[model samples]
Target chain A: MFEHFPQRVLVNEVVTRDGFQSEAEFVPTATKIELINALSTQGLNKIEVTSFVSPRAVPNLRDAEEVVTALNRNTDTTYVALVPNERGCGRALALDLDEINLVMSVSETHNLANMRMTCAQSLDQFARISAMTAGSAMRLNGSLATAFGCPFEGLQTEDTVLHYIEAYLEQGLHSITLADTTGMAVPNQVYSLCRAVRARWPDLEVTLHFHNTRGLGLSNVLAALAAGMNQFDASLGGLGGCPFAPGATGNICTEDLVHMLAEMQLDCGVDLAGLLTQSRQLEAIVGHPLPGQINKAGLRTDTRPVPESVTQLRQSLEA
Target chain B: MFEHFPQRVLVNEVVTRDGFQSEAEFVPTATKIELINALSTQGLNKIEVTSFVSPRAVPNLRDAEEVVTALNRNTDTTYVALVPNERGCGRALALDLDEINLVMSVSETHNLANMRMTCAQSLDQFARISAMTAGSAMRLNGSLATAFGCPFEGLQTEDTVLHYIEAYLEQGLHSITLADTTGMAVPNQVYSLCRAVRARWPDLEVTLHFHNTRGLGLSNVLAALAAGMNQFDASLGGLGGCPFAPGATGNICTEDLVHMLAEMQLDCGVDLAGLLTQSRQLEAIVGHPLPGQINKAGLRTDTRPVPESVTQLRQSLEA
Candidate 1:
């Protein structure tokens, strides 16, 4: 059934940044470093480490600089940081980050709500940031937040999203991430938008970041895959939600995603058992049960012990 | 994107049987009747009202007879009951049910664990029941439990499943349900099995019953849809779990499923808002939060009240 699918898909783990930023309690910088170092060993090619945002705006990630600076960077993994503006860009560049992920909302309302800037204003900032890194070795990836839907504006048109992509491309940022910020994307919408985006920019490295808020996260993954997307962003333990959107849930669980892909015989280089172990440590640090299903329910390959009743019944029948 | 898909899909609400049977608390027969009656008006074409099983095994559904007898059935809806054996068949036949749904496992270990009978013994029972109901006006639909994968047996081969299907066909049962009893099915498996089954039995009405145990429930639904299978079984608020399988979660949320189908412009003939309201009531009665995502996230059409920060940011930007 998946004979036509790519042999291997690229997965970028975004837990340290996306997952931790939404937490009510600050995850200690030491703990963040520990998690990132652990994730690096799990065969993940990319890990979003931290966000260089204002301390007051997101107190939970106030230790972003400390966490990034103290990380035991793995040579095989690219450690990226979320840089919302030129200020964030400067901070991340000073830290010698592998990649600076700049984000802007495709929806006008969401851009203002999230970054306190208009879409045009955010794009102008991104252009300035692009110019600043022109002669540098820094790689930039732009994320179009609410590319699928917005909490304030509801559904977004494909033209609206493509306009933002056009702006990002004009700024010389080739790698793009389409985010379903409000988790409102259905499979058809995912398929249609992804197909259109890939068609328009055939060379653009498209990555899908989906939220499981409406239980359509993995379904959207399948849709995006069918539409020819190869890169995806997922968080450990399904941690992370839109701080601006009330009741929005986390990104698709990284362990859960790997489990499904492995079950389908798709190559997702990460180790599922290792990710679950990390997820367990994360659950301990977070002091709660995670929203991830695979971590809670063992992998399909792990068999359950036969119940005593079944054993007794089998013996009785044999007798 | 859905140009090649069927215009409408059939959904059978299994809340009364699948959902209630898993609850620790015995919901009153009157309440069960009220819920079933409410479901009948929600544009659902089929509803599995109850399971006529040994009350000792599923004490929560002890009042199945009373609940089935008291329902206000809609003429457009088919009221079905789960009949595990000939005794349950007699009880369901006495009530003049629209459909008598017989279930058995495709995996040997799961059959022993769940039904305390061998695969052959279950088939023999089904054949006897089929013979008994031959001259009657009742319709029989067979459910191949763990058709996708078994918790005890891990995964069942397509040939193993097809062998069971042949037996059901030989017993004169036309309509069949392929149940993912332990939520172990992935999209590739669901797509391949469903397509193959439909190909072999062109006249058979195929229904897919999936669990959200590992969060692939709705994704499997999409895969089955692509494979030409239409009918699905979903529970309200995702309330249901296998009693034998530890850590197995509920069936795919009926409200969540409807919400996705409606958003995709697929015809399900179900009211999403009404189902959410009923789900809310079910949560209250169950005295706990349900496993559904849509009920908590609200519908995509719902406009969230602007966060104070967003409102203030907009005003400052305007200034």
Candidate 2:
């Protein structure tokens, strides 16, 4: 039944790297690896294992190299890592990563706040890094941060976002992502951006990285789907929040997203039950309730009769 | 600018009754009143205050009559109470509710499982109740439960749901709500049901009630919106779940729904910030976290530069 449907859904798991990085408590390396390997069983096409930022800046992902090197990568699954600069690129390169994602903000205010550099300077740096990775086995992807709307600037225009994309493409990057880092991208903005991007660059492999900050994450996904873009980056249980961005919310809940896709009669190729079990494990490891809905409330496949159970429990309690 | 939008979104708050009833613990009656009053200030047009069910069945709502009687009853807002039978109707009538919503399942199996009676018996009861309520000032709204799909029976036909609506109309109840009780609804199901129901009853006021069980709640809302159904029932922070039907998730999050409506430039007349504050307060009163997203991240409102005091504190922390 599912084979006839086009493979329009691509889930990118960021649980290990993005989810754990925001935590004040340290997650052991073994737990991080366990989470990544468990995610592979759910048939994810890509998994963002870690970021190669300086250890001093983000202590949680200091073991980025070890996590990436130890991944049980299948032939179909592509393992990617975030690289912020030249030093970060060196770490990813040493691990023989499948893809290295480079990010720069479109909003000047956010660009300075997040990367501590002017927009032009970040572009220049990406150009240098793009040159270094060209023709190598590893693919380079440029991420346009704050491309939807900026917390400081209020709204980032399509023209400004396009200019940055053009620059990235001019530097020979094969893939690009428009990220709503602060979850400011509404459905209208997402629809317009996806249409314009595909219209502007028909062959560009556009991936969307959205946050559920204002609850527009999945709706934004629908908008992107309507615009014919498929690839998405999500965290299981919506676990991650940007540490630097104040009031930033969780990533799109992976199970929720998969459930939506599966019922829409779209081919997501994910085991919803397996993902729910993994989410419960994630909640246990994190030592707090994770923000996923499907894990707490199992799917239609879980057909345990309720009133009988409730009656027996009530009778037991009363007795 | 928002006043000109063709679609005026209406959010019916279902937290006080649906949300609290799902919890095992009893929420203090005073807290329920406070939450409803707070929601009134958030520009919600309607609030489903409490259900007048037998106290023995749902002990959480033992004080339903008292809670309904104490509502603020603001002139601009409509207060609704759920009445399951004539006994429940007597209690609701004493409270002089603005609207009395009568709920019955569309599927025969669910009607038997949920209300412990056949569909014919429920309709006969509704006919008698409609006669009793004929000349009253209170508006009677008949809700067709499990209109989309049911846990007991897999899927409900559009013909069956429309038949129930027609029966309610014959019994003089013009307002109707189509409920996806188990969240087994998809966009196609919503579109078909709305089209069929609207075609039969041209002037009927139809509301769509969806659970986020399969993560299609908001997407189903969009489908209903596309088919011209504007009113929706949502719980604060998506807090409601079905006790009779296990695996049934909570209602759509009110803040998340309002945020989407507002961002799409639709006029919901809801105060987003005030709703967020109430969500946080609701979280505290319930002594648990919520599924609300907009509250954790502020709206797309323009952010001011960091105050010098906070900047100094941030700098100190970095140092």
Per-residue CA lDDT of model 2 for A87-188, tens digit only, reads 888778888889988888998777777787667878888888877877779888889998988777778889999999999987777799899888888776
Clashes of 2: 0
**Residue A43 deviation, candidate 2, in Å?**
2.8
> Which 10 residues in a row give candidate 1 chain B its minimum summed lDDT?
B241-250
For model 2, the DockQ equals: 0.36
Q: After superposition, how far is residue A70 of candidate 2 from its true place, in Å?
A: 3.1
Candidate 2, residue B141: how far the Cα is off, in Å: 0.8
lDDT of 1 by residue, B113-153 (tens): 88889989998998899988988988999999989888777
**Model 1 lDDT, residue A139, Cα:** 88
TM-score of each: 0.97, 0.88
In terms of TM-score, the best-performing candidate is 1
Decoy 2 TM-score against native: 0.88
